[model samples]
Target: MKITKLETVIPRDIMPGLLALRIHTDAGHIGHGETYYVPEAVASTIHDWMAKRLLGANPLEIESHWRFLYERTTNFGSRGCELRAISAIDLALWDILGQVCDQPVWQLLGGRSQDKIPVYNSSAGPSYAGKSNEPHDSHVWPGHGCVGHEGPLNDYWSVVNRPTEYVQELLDEGYRAVKMWTLDFAAHKHGGPLYLSKQDLEVGLRPMRAIRDAFGNQIEIMLDGHGFFQLPTAVRIAKAMREIDPLWLEDVIRPDCVDTIADFRRQTDVPLAVSEMMIGMEDYRLVLEKRAADYIMIDPTWVGGISQTHRICNMAQSYNVPVVMHDCTGPLTLLSGLQVGTATTNVAWQETVRSQIRMIYPKLISGTIQVEAGYAHASDEPGIGGRWLPELFEGSTYQHRVSEAGR
Candidate 1:
């Protein structure tokens, strides 16, 4: 079926960085996709540029459409919003393919590799959802510094202030792993990532040490540095983290230089999970080639959606390195990760912010994501599983942009 229209909606009141994309086809199938951060720019790319390549094209030709968009954008630098826009469109195309074939996305991607995958909790609160009213700069940076109330699911705040209690709660709830960004505060306090004092380093390690003291080996601890540290500081953090024996240190430094990451990895005993910041396959290829990361993190939405995610996962598999799906962004992002994570044999963990899943996700999407114990099951439903709620587009505060074929 030919694609007839492409539409995007950004919620102005809540979750402002979220952009919900819909591809309408002549065959009555409407495929849904979404990407987080920079909604206005992503929406513009979808309508003003990417829409022309998609309109009137065969909706099921997912690969051709993906390639066409990628090739054109790379000539002009394809990262950030451009690649994110392509990622949303790629997801929509796959969703349409799943619907047309009457199969779930996981099944369409070579059936299930596993029944379920283990999930790791990331310390995030409801405020992590997005900033209200602000369309741009919607991402919430870590470290509230005693700002908000101690509500349930406000794990980010709790983790720093009440580390022992937070670990106990997650352990009681069946989570085997938990990730935090407590070091970010030090990075900002030090004026930059260039330096970290002995005092601040001790402060940063306190929560992590508390978790190990209280729960010991009961829960796996992962530290996210938010790509904020320079080499010397990142090395120091990694060296200190060795005491706790974390599951992995993720993005302790940026993934900008594979050679530098390789250098860092050589210096530390702590296993490093490289990054989700790598935009596409080419970025990932270098990471794999350099042997930089012990585990590779891929954000399905940010890494060009399911198509590129699958390719990267396989490439990592070739290196015998496990894949971890990154999804602290949005529901479609989490759902898209599940679809591919369940189908990829080497995938190790799927990251989840329980706060976002329970507090923010239900407001925007229509279906429930099944997570029992610590394992998440892929949706058996066709086309990316959950659809964005019709009411999400009905609000007066929601902004809509569209591109129709032959316009």
Candidate 2:
């Protein structure tokens, strides 16, 4: 079927907003896709830059469209928002293909690999990033759950004020794992450079000791480096975490530095979860060849779309490396990531800001994708949900809207 119209849908209610692609076709089918971002800009990129490329093209040509949008942007851009725009469109095209064939997106990718994959709570809040501190309001961030929440739940999750109680609640909820951060305050909140003194190091690591004391071996805890620490400090932290037997240490020394990552890996026996910033297979191939990480985290939103992500997963699978999909970006990122997670064989775990289960997602979108007992199930819906309520568009409108190709 020919693509008839192109538009961007933004659910204003969602924190930071989710910029989604809506591709309507002559076959009476519409596909939904998304990019993690500033919705307005991503939306503009889709309409102003990508729409004409897709307007009259066959909607089912996912790979062809992906290449077209990607190749054309070679000089101007490729990796960042340009790739993000293409990612959203690629997913939308897949949604259309799934609808055309009367199969769910997951099934079309490769059939359900498992009823549900194992998952780890990101200990984040409603912002889609894990919360560092418990939000006083209903809000919680989806940042790495490194920070703690006090007096209920708070924003900016770091080490929780009551690690014992928090871990207890997560275990009670049937969650098998949790990922929290311990280094962001020094790197992100403290203005400039990270300088951890002896006391600072102890304070940074206090949560790890508490979490170990609280859960012991019963619960799997993952540590996030936020990719913000110096190599020496990262190595020290990784070596220290060995005592707790963490599930994995993530982005400890920044992912782009293969040597630094390798050095960190060498210094500590702690299992490592490498970067999610991977975009193409070439980079993934190099990381795998170098053996920089025991587990590789891929954020499909930042990487390529489902198509590229699948390629990356298969590449990782060839090396016997486990793939972990990240979802702290936004709703479509979570949905599409889970779709890939459900269909891929090597994806060991899926990351989520667990707090979204409460109010964020329900209030943000017209569709629903739930995480049950710490695992997420794929939606049986024909296409990704993009029929946003008009209320979501109250003060906004599509940056550029295209009519049906055959109209």
Candidate 3:
């Protein structure tokens, strides 16, 4: 069928957040996709810019449509907002294609490598304050197995006062892997910059070391440097944490400098994880081609949806590099990433923020994502298996300032 309409909806949220696109065809089927960006205003900017080209194109020609959008926006640059827009449209097209063919998106990509892909708790443990409490508050837990089946507790609780207690809690919950932000964002105030200082590095690795010592190698620990350091400092910190033996060091340096990433990779023995901020195939290509990272990370919302993610994963597989899908956003993002993970053979693991799980699970339309023994299983359902619930957006507010043409 031919394309007839393209619609965008930006769900109002705490930060400039998730933008959803609905692509309608003459045959009356609509596909769904989402693009994640910031300044909150970029959503509307991208929506309007892409609308001009997408209005009457053939929705099924996913590759051609992707290229047209990419070339048309070359002058605007391809890294951030433009790529994010492309991602949303590309994803919606995949959704439409799946609906038309009567198959799950994963099957369309290629059959599943495994029925369920193993998932890691990307953001479990303590909160930013370093509190010992569970990653989520009381309101967030909707009860175990509410979505489909009972899964392990994958929460990202922050403990401000008791760091040791936090580690104990996760181990007690039967969680084998957990990720925590070591350097304090607020701690940057004490130093001239936000990066870890010599003292900061000592302080930061203490908790990680303690957790490792307490739990031993049986537990896989991950650290989020949060792009808080320059390349040199990042290398130093990664080297320092080598003793801790982290599963991966995440987004340690800014994504802008490919050369710097290469430099960091050369200096550190730790497996570097990059690309939480990347938006499309070009960004993924740069990271892969440069050999800049041991593990490539892509958020489906930010990185041109399921179709592009599949392409990127295939490329990574050729390089013998594994991919870890990033999921620090809402539920739609989690489900979207799940579709890609199931179809990908080289995916290392999928990231999940237990703190946001409670807020996101209710939005699912069908099937269930059951987590067992630290792995996630996708439902045998069509589409992404999720729906946009009006109640989730009840108190949410969004501001859209699209150019007349973009609108």
Candidate 3 runs further than 4 Å off: 13-16, 39-42, 124-174, 190-195, 361-368, 390-407
Rank by lDDT (best first): 1, 2, 3
Q: Tell me the tens digit of each residue's lDDT in model 2 across 243-285.
A: 7789899887767778778777877889898878766566788
lDDT string for model 3 (188-278, tens) is 4444134556776776677778877776886788887666568767877788888999888887777888878888998888988887766
lDDT of 1 by residue, 77-142 (tens): 899899899889989889999999889999999999999999999998777765422122223353
Q: What are the models' TM-scores?
A: 0.96, 0.88, 0.82
Superposed by TM-score, candidate 1 places the C-alpha of residue 57 at a distance from the truth, in angstroms, of: 1.3
Candidate 3, residue 294: Cα displacement in angstroms equals 1.3
Between prediction 2 and prediction 3, the one with superior TM-score is 2
**Cα RMSDs of all predictions?**
2.3, 3.9, 6.6
Local distance difference test, candidate 3? 0.66
Looking at model 2, residue 269 earns an lDDT score of 89
243: Cα error in model 3, Å: 2.2
